[model samples]
Target: MDEMMPHSHLPAVGVADDEPSLAGVIAEDVAAWCRRLSSTLLEETGESLLGKLRAEADILRTLVDGEGSVVDGQPQAPPYRDRKGRLRNQTNPVTSARNPVAPPMALVGSDGESEFSVVLPIQYQGPPKTLHGGYVSVLLDETMWHAVRTALDGISFTRELTVTYERPVPLGVPLTVRGRVTSTDGRKTFAEGEVLAGGEVCARASGLWIAPRR
Candidate 1:
């Protein structure tokens, strides 16, 4: 009978013993033990630990390439692709709009007190050539929220917002909205905002924001 050829690359599995070869059985047991241990660590430590492990695994990957050794785990990559269509390279979208007199006002300042401005075009008219009252209200709301954030500490959400239009905001000119926090009481904060054009206040607003309960 012909003798079995030894695998040069792979380590021998069987051990010389009177009983059945223990190398294969021991390796399988060790692998299962490692899997169970990793699962337990993940369950106890949560996702942060997993993220660190993934980063470390990536660093170790260079050592194993071209060695005919394949790690059983998948490569860690971001869920979304980048603009260039490469794996793991991605960017968050810009949150601010080009124009301020619109829904979903864009954030404009690094500090809590933020100022945003917009030029009223002829197309955004209420009557003949004046800006719409609704558009003015949107600016007031955004300004008030920014003010509230500036005055208070921690995160806050708007509770009640009220605006009073003083005069008609003219079109074909730039309108500036300034927001600042007036006062705060525990979780509740009070804020004031105003829309100005040509150094005159066209609209004014006051609002309350409540900090989320822990």
Candidate 2:
């Protein structure tokens, strides 16, 4: 299904900060709360807590919404790049410390192949104790593109992604995701990736990435 999604022309670049910022820490905390809420069953109304959260959300929205940096006295718009000039959106969602929705994915290694360790929570459950197939596809696509940006030349976009589900991805268990370039032909680069649970392949994908013309 990832193949049918409209491709964005935005440049894919760079790794996130090696160290976590205060904001990143806060985001992760919020994400943790969200995960708890997802799994918890409430016998009574949560309106009081919901009200407090709504007020907090308003405060946060004011701070983050439409906020941009003043680079050299020039106000930049949304989607600002980091100090290292890497685009913010290109940060690894799987391993991002700042994104609340991002799973607790830790980077194991990335030389030519990008590898990550992750465990999907109940929020990502599609069926009884299994990871959603769509999320699996998205993760594979992201990892494969990360491999392309890490190992190939120039910026690339997803042209096609084919994901095969071998087994149900069980939630709340350790999983490994890995991607690497398999071959390159002219403007296109072919990459393959997989998600493994309990040392066995659960989901695997192959994708075509195309570098735009300069």
RMSD of each: 26.2, 7.8
Q: lDDT of all predictions, in order shown?
A: 0.55, 0.67
What residue runs in model 2 are displaced by over 4 Å at the alpha carbon? 1-24, 41-93, 108-111
Instruction: Put down candidate 2 lDDT per residue, 76-163, tens digits, no spaces.
Output: 1123365567655423445554345667466643555888788777778888899989999988887777787777656778889999
lDDT of 1 by residue, 120-213 (tens): 5554578777878977776776566666655555657667777888999987677778887777788877878888899899988887777878
After TM-score superposition, what is the CA distance of residue 51 in candidate 1 from its true location, in Å?
56
Cα deviation at 97, candidate 2, in Å, is 2.2
Error of 1 at 186 (Å): 1.0
Best by TM-score: 2
- Candidate 1 has a TM-score of 0.49
Query: How much does candidate 2 score in TM-score?
Result: 0.67
Per-model TM against the reference = 0.49, 0.67
Model 2 accuracy (lDDT, Cα): 0.67
